[model samples]
Target: MPGSAPLTTKDGRFGYEAAGDPASQPLLFLHGIGGAARAWRGQLDFFRDRYRTIAWDMPGYGGSAPLPDVSIAALAGALQDFLQAVGATNPVIVGHSIGGMIVQQWLAKNPRTAGAVVLAQTSPAFGKPDGDWQKSFIDARLGPLDRGETLVTLAPSLVNELVGDDPDASGMDLARDCMAAVPGATYRATMLALMGFDLRSALKAIAVPTLVLSGSKDNNAPAPMMAKMASYIPSATYVELEGVGHLANLERPLAFNAALDQFLKANVTATQVTA
Candidate 1:
């Protein structure tokens, strides 16, 4: 019931694409950088029939509006406003990649989350990257989306890189479409925001049943780095998806769904009791 409607918050407007049973529990989904809410289509189709699932497009990405000011904390505050607007007292928040970092920071201020999951990624503070990593926000990969290049011409190359070696041409194509649909200014601002933000300490402050899943082959957020994240979060459960890339949910939907199902089942009962 909560999944299908539009929820307007103090910060901006929020919406979710849902399907599952109306009577089931609620689950909020967050996507990665340059990703739209539809990125969770696999999970939406699988769990919406059993659980009330709602996925969001991050500010400045997908259908969501641009942020007043782009920063992890600002996004976190917007998330809080969204939850309150939607009247989600304690919905389980599930996020991927950069989304995971925002979720962690959001939970630091609002500890009322039923549970949270970090899928196929970790925070920006994982392994010590090169000194220029944080400073370099604009690059050739996102030149079109960040600058003035046309999406029709830029979609192919950028989409191929986003999909990596997923072996799912269809999924890759869909992601490419979403990326192409994104506005250049929105894409650029969001990437700039992600560059300097760090949530290392926020991991420990999160006081919810959390699941952290990493892809072994994820060059973006590798296993060793996520493993360290799992170690930091006192209540986090770590699981690595083998032979998968950054887009684990899309790359290996079966494995991704299985892991998600297990985490939900394990926490569903406890969450009900607490609620």
Candidate 2:
């Protein structure tokens, strides 16, 4: 298995960490608001032997350039450009949290761009932006920064809330490091960008083979929400990983990788045969 290393596009607009064989089928991993490219290290290493695995630090995270504005459409556009730059055609996309939202937005615009999609521990909507719940959600996260605390100071508690009841120490450390490294401005922008996101209606139009993976203990994107999300897409398969939390890939890498491998083999093989 190959290790992840920094990679830049020819245009220098995007930066990512890539592993695996360039000649193999591409598998792209997108991380959540609290994550960076390194969040998918386990997946990249696990799948590198069989696929060209790449994990991107979304625009504004890691060394990637920040977008002028943060919104689902804009993020999706950035993803489109990144795909083109990397020469990936109809690759498999494995997205977590907001990363899953980006994949959904991208699929809404380019239904045929992916060979398959894995929506892991994410929701189809953020609920009403003006609703009390939304306000509370945003306030709770932003209030810390408002009080003059940096991400480094808030990372421990934030990550604690996001992980499972019993999480690996190493996974917790990685999550903390990723969250702590995020710039305050970018984190705030991303939080606000998700305010009015709603793609429930567009799920049925996703024509590619899809897998919805959920963590049984994920409070943020609960199993029920993921099940409903899976139901919206035609013939989508839903798998719940017991004892895992929002960071399913990190919390239970072996199980996560196994589920993904099974899905890719079945769906990618079928798609190739039909083509």
Candidate 3:
């Protein structure tokens, strides 16, 4: 509720929503492919009292400009710029789905930039681009857009598939609205960019405290896969939220926030005290 207002970076190239004390430790949220900054509204409100909570619209989503070349590295570079623009130092970064991929990419390049990280409903690898499974996965998502169906028309059903069976009505509406608002070109490019993603080798290099969260019912990033990913990270803790789906934050905000709080208290707060 606090970060309901839209905001832009000092240069106006990136758009986001912000709440809480600017001087406090920052909590930066990155949404999934189907989400924009508004997708983290619950998080911004929940964490506002203690942290400078901010949710960003990734490049080409919402009010942000499109990246000239969409890739994990490019998105990570954009994230670095966004962090500098916002004046966040060693922030707690939370990312979902493809957003999590971007987080991994950033950490690979700037290993010491974050105090902690939350990777929810995401994978360390997208699989080989030429693999049968990967090819089918890309085609299934792109086929709809290639057929001239706009995201506005396809969003309802697309979002429905990513949520749990007993999803909150308001959450469903929010997910649909955010997905519908994505530019078709951006969505297409993002899907293609994912084809080349492979961060399996970078997992062990994550030196900061990390939380790998998965929805038990998530089909996109299965619980077992996320668990394996956590095993590879030296300082990682894995959490599985039962009855939730790919849209963990939206599907079950309380559970999602609780896991995040636990990580913050154990890792972030203690780090602050030691510093």
lDDT of every predicted structure (CA atoms): 0.69, 0.89, 0.89
Assess candidate 3 and give its TM-score to the true structure: 0.96
Q: After superposition, how far is residue 267 of candidate 1 from its true place, in Å?
A: 2.4
Q: After superposing candidate 2, which stretches have Cα over 4 Å from the reference? A: 270-275
For candidate 3, lDDT tens digit of each residue in 1-275?
Answer: 34456899879899999887777888999988889999988989998888888999999999888899998889999999999988888789998999999999999998987989999899999988899999999899989988989999999999988987588778888999999999998999888888868989989899999999999899999999999999999999999999998998888888888999988988886222111
Write one digit per residue (lDDT tens) for candidate 1, span 192-274.
66665666866676677788898877777878988987888778788988877777777777888899889878865423212
TM-score of each: 0.85, 0.96, 0.96
- Sorting all predicted structures by TM-score, with the top scorer first, yields 3, 2, 1
Q: Which residue runs does candidate 1 get wrong by more than 4 Å?
A: 1-12, 124-130, 140-148, 164-166, 270-275
After best superposition, candidate 3 residue 219: deviation in angstroms?
0.6
Kindly report which residue pairs in candidate 1 clash with one another. Answer: 20-48, 20-49
